[model samples]
Target: MTDSGERNTMTRRTVIGAGIGAGIGGAAALTAAGFEPAPAFAGGSGKTVRLTVMGTTDLHGNVFNWDYFKNAEYDDSAHNDIGLAKISTLVSAVRDRIAADRHAPRPLMLDAGDTIQGTPLAYYYAKIEPITGGHTHPMAAAMNRIGYDAAALGNHEFNYGLDILRKFQRQLRFPLLGANAQDWTTGLPAFPPYVLKRVHVPGEKPITVGILGLTNPGIAIWDKANVENKLKFGGIVELARQWVPKVRAAGADLVIASVHSGMDLSSSYGDALPYPENASVLMAETVPGIDAVLVGHAHLEIPERLVTNKTSGEQVVLSEPLKWGMRLSLFDLDLQKVRGQWKVVARHSQVLNANTVDADRDVVALLQKDHDKVVQYVNSKIGTCTEAMSAATAPWEDTAALDFVNFVQADAVSKALAGTPQASLPVLAIAAPFNRDAAIPAGDVSVRDVAGLYVFDNTLLAVTMTGTQVKEYLEFSAQYFKQISGTGPFPSDQVTNAPTSTAPNGTPDYNYDIVGGLTKPLTYKIDIAKAPGARITDLAYGGTPVAADQQFVVAVNNHRQSGGGNFPHIKTAPVVYNRQVEIRQLMIDYVTTTGTVDPKTFHTTDWSLTSNGTPITVTT
Candidate 1:
């Protein structure tokens, strides 16, 4: 990433002598005062010590300028120009900055993971690209151009199964690190856990920086079947505690954790307690020698440079650049020698907006070449729709798009399971409203639109749940919508601020809405405080009282059934069918099966909220 403009002004460099003594407590104040001293040059070597670390995380395979769902070109102005070509420009700028600073150290580029699977490009490679030896992943090829020194593995890396993951790692130019990911049977790291580098900064002696990686432990539950045969993830904190000291003993001067986890400050989900951020905070506090943490997974930006270890009083920086090459995290650290030991004197962090920089010519060329290939492959029209197909939108209260997705998934699963003993049961499809960019407009839907709706490329999983469990599932999803009371008729102004039973006249609702089968008139009253599974009251299915033991076939993405979405009941249910079909491909199949789809065919008005024998005002 190269910058086009030169620095307009330069500050005078501070100098320090051997006789001057500075206390650790005063270092922060000194740094603030701009009294910090530059690292001394190596004796007679004319070398100055300066090192820059560049990081990117959650690059969900936005390798080309094509929109997977719209099947059209992405507008660069919409802040959607995320491609390897754009990232290369940023890398070039960083390299140029280091070159301009005569005393600056060599630069190190690192990725925080989630690079392999997101867009159609990735899907094309994973599903259609040959499994022959020396197969190249477009994302990995782009990362090579960016010249990453090392990276940590994220949970999404395992989505394609251990074989593909190993193949990806084998193809990458840089080493992939994950200290906690290990072989369960052998009790050894599945891959190299960390890498140590002796970076030479201008005007200073060489310093050893250790980069250790850890993936979220939740992969065991989320990618259970995909990884069950090959690997295991250990506790994050425990692994950090055991490894940080080892990295230090290996002569590391500074320890940086490349963690693919996240933090959440709000109490929303029942399973929010054991999130990546909480684990990260705890790891920084308990680990003895960690200096900084680079986070991913949650995909939110942590704009400030956080000082997590207040007790040790050490400044442990935690940061995350936004996902999809939308932003680049630029961490500027001032290193100074204290008693012959290198310590970070001052720190600053910022996210670079890709839209602000010019595209890297080489990266753009590479992507364009690949883009042409992908376009030709996807353009040969797999199928057609007779009518417009769309998901529900706000202020309308009903979504045809979501309903179509459920109907297709349920139908497929039911037919697949018919020969089995579970076929006799009523099947209910489980899905979430994953409106990625926005709702699909009602019209002739394209392959790109379908991709946008289900871009994750998840697999299909069939599970057996009781009718009672099905009701619990609906109640759990209803938490996303707030039921407005005392509001005017349908589509009124009050609908936006409608009060739920729990709100004191006016409060926001944090529940997810659920749609069920049409056999029963679905109705329920809100009951907060009860655990998610306990929230439903007066539940019935098809006019029959639901029994806890009554089995029903539930169709859902493999991620949810394997516990990825953190839903309560599905995680514990018995797996009845594990379809090898990819969600993206399934949508493609559905569209191709019914050429020129009408959106009305997908539209549904089966479920609604009621108050005092009157329907609550719903937008759409």
Candidate 2:
């Protein structure tokens, strides 16, 4: 890797042959049987170069197939594996195959961001043994060993602020690209917008592939406190339009966009900004020079998608590997020299499942100590609980588990607002049943127990809203339930996980919010018999009917406060307090400082669902 600050370039010595492998590992040999280069035309000259680009995104700090929150091996309903350890094995196998063939170009390893935040390992480095204190982040240590050529900046990369992010960037072996992340003062690209790589093919001129990176524009709203005036995020499509042309003019033979946005053309912020949050498809459809795109940020697994450019009339390939290193995206492009220049003639992409490969031994050995430290950290007992509290019923019924989260959040916000002008306003807190399996054991409570309650890396904030707005917020959240005709006993699955335009598959667990009050209980019923906008009924605070004009200070997470779920009025609501404290750490701190997990002090049966005022019975 050569770094000139203006142009970062790398040369690939080993080029793959025409025939690419169809397997996850290198066992399947590459032969010339399947692929045949185009015949030489009248003026066509030179050889066919086969180049491969492998990508991973939203890696969220998983280096092993282990869940620190569960204190066990990672296992979900899908039975999918995760972490860079598994990804390294697949990368090594592919590289080994390329080397043995002697005709394949050395594969380029790239990531599409979200590398620094997620899991207890990420949290320990960010807050406990802070990388800012000169300690190397576990992610930097492991990824450096993996030897990534370049990586795009993800929105979560800024969760810990610029200081930690810069430190992590300085420790890396390659440049971190962010084209749309501009300096507010200069309105220019803050990080290296793109990187150039010259693939050296024997007996032919080197093939130059330019990689451009773009981040989510919603960062301007999602992380307003951390980057309000310091940085400005631009739309992905516009940024691609501006930078892809520059990359082409730089003499790149092929242009690949490593974008940290989803293929869906949608925004969670709902017109709060000019740009949509996930616009990879829109960018591909509008941008002409792009040859391929590695998509991220939505955490969905899209093996391959082809979007045709409107202006160029060229088909562009796009792929997204599942998040948390569950899969790897591979792009194989065969280029032929035409008119004295290398031009891509044929290209295709596919995803390899990470579960099929074992964790790379070297990667596991490199970070064994770091992994052990996090395991110890999460397993340490912080407090004791008199009775177990589970979130299993939180989705359909008011459970003490979710109440515990609201209790801790509201208490903190209320204390922070004390002596301030907002002290007179009632403090309410919002929480979601992120994990139905999250539970506080009866006898002892560990960090992982509380961490399981809130899986996302969200921070706490205090926003001001009127009683009318609060009702509107609840009404919007009530849309998570499907409309039922009668109040007879019904299966929980039948009543929940309704589909919306924003969420085609069904509403995610994070989108359904539960609001609770601090000093007094905030009670309301979700009327499933009514339509979405009018679902909230019996809205009251402290047993008094909530007045539409009554003002309240609500404790909320960064995601919801920043318009993540498109909940009404929260993003536009005035922020009364913004401490930028992670909610997971806050709960851990509360338990450690208090030395007891008594739900009696925090839990309140404040909310329920009903059918026209008759309580709706739900069976789990």
Candidate 3:
């Protein structure tokens, strides 16, 4: 046996050919970060097995490049390329690349879940014309046509319930796997744990590769209504420890983890919880036999990151493609004959921009009917906005767009709590500016406009908390802004996210909350110059100092009620009511029921940000 400079132990083959065809994403916009061109290989007297692994995560029911928000093809968002149609195009391009050169074998296509929910299109199928109700789900059909080998279940899979998830699993040709989600009665895997596949080359023996699937353990809390009595989710690391060896024992030469989770190691739900939301990094560091990890659920795009396994001191490749079908994780594996047996010589991972490729006309034709239906539904007028409401200044100031969202919740819950124990209690609602770029036209408001305001499928929950608890929640949210010192008439662009880039935009927009129903102005300043958790000051309510236990019913989404954001006091707070309906639908109902949203009546100047007793000039 002989070795070269590129084969000492582990060598990275960077460039996967002259790629990046120009489309929506120009040549300059296409980037495969941390990737280099492949070096020339020496033709030896050994069998070579060259194959590609293509993956997508957090598809969230996008079958076309159309946006339900704008009621047209997507534009001016973080991601230009969207849906399985675009992904199908990328898949063919990769296959063509392989065919042109080695033509070794067909590529393995995979997905890390969150496939069923996000847009109105997914909702239309899951709720309106369910597959169980004899309708073909668009996501399932598109993926089946694309030919997925295997997939992991995402936490959102349970948002609709077990019956719906079971129906979806049965509808697909490939197996839907979840190693951690277990049956409550038997403490056994609820779905298939892992799948083994054999790749047969023309002149070589069949090579066995195992795909292990893992889902976010937050299913226990986030979907407690759907999974509580029937299933329990275990920790990814602990469960991987149990399942990896079993898969290897089942005649697998290589193992891949299709993990529907993120790479953050810190436990967001605290250490006592069995599994925190983001633990992919921990899974790679501790688990053995895992060659690579495909991650999702945090909606981050990590082109390539190498993790060192602590047990064997071996390197494992981890890749997370951007959500909404914006990017694909393309990994190429080089296999060489070893003493008459073929083994992987090296592995290379990188992200391919979905916008760089054109959408497959065939896939679009397959789902065009479903796409048209969603467009029609979203375009229907729901009501009217008396004045223009824009989220453009929401991140910096308490804009009218947020006041409209907050008022909807506060009013709806106030009526929902009638005749209940918390009926007489004063109510306030907490809402985040989900769309930083959303704007509602002055004249007519469509169902799409209101749906765009509350992008997530969150449910409403009214929890009893003190005025002090409300202040504490606001303090937790103030952590979303950055620390800015030497303040003058600072523009709102200075009002972006907190410095921690755990996510691409630092502090996520979902964490920034604004409240309604305060008697006095809820003017608490976020001193960006100070550290998080210590930045909020001037907390007051109703023109008087708030006492520790001055109770009030605060309306929030089920995610917060399920302890999603790791905010203090909210998860442990007493719940007065839990509405199992979608909050977006409620907003739809609110606007239509009220007939008109006069910004003059609902918009409030209840919040402000000041430096040295003078408010900074915020302009985004």
Backbone atom clashes (below 3 Å) for every candidate: 56, 8, 7
**lDDT tens per residue, model 1, 1-620:** 11232211211211111111221112332232122233443443222244567788888787644464555434544544565656566667667656766767777777787887777677667766733345688887888877888889887777677778888888888899999888979979998989999988655678889999988776765566687767877877789988988998898888888887775432112252254423676777767677778778777777545665745677777778778776676666666676777766555555665544445555555555555556655654655555444444422255566666666677777877767798788777755656624444455455665665665656777778876677767765654434444545545334333344454454322124344442233334433324333445656566556677877787778667656635668877877766345777777767767765565554556555455444555554
lDDT of 3 by residue, 1-620 (tens): 00011212211211111122332222222332222434434466675566678899999888766656665455445546678877887777666655655447777989999998877788778776777897778889989988899999998888788888899999999999999989999989999999998887766777788899999887776566688889989999999999999998997877889999899775434443666778898999999888889998877889888888999776788899988888889777667777765555666788877765666666767776787676666776768888889887788888888988887787877887778788888788888888977878888888888878887868787788997788778878887776676555666656667656454557778878887773334456666667677766666665566667888888889788778878888888876666345688778777878878898887767777655445667665
lDDT of 3: 0.76
Evaluate all candidate structures by whole-model CA lDDT and list the values in order: 0.63, 0.83, 0.76
List the candidates ranked by TM-score, beginning with the highest: 2, 3, 1
TM per candidate comes to 0.69, 0.77, 0.73
C-alpha displacement of 36 in model 1, angstroms? Answer: 17
The weakest ten consecutive residues by lDDT in model 3 span 1-10
lDDT of 1 at 416: 74
Off-target runs (Cα >4 Å) in candidate 1 are 1-50, 72-81, 130-133, 264-278, 308-312, 383-401, 408-446, 452-514, 518-540, 543-620
RMSD per candidate (Å) reads 10.9, 8.9, 9.8
Best-to-worst ranking by lDDT: 2, 3, 1
Best model number under TM-score: 2
Error of 3 at 587 (Å): 2.6
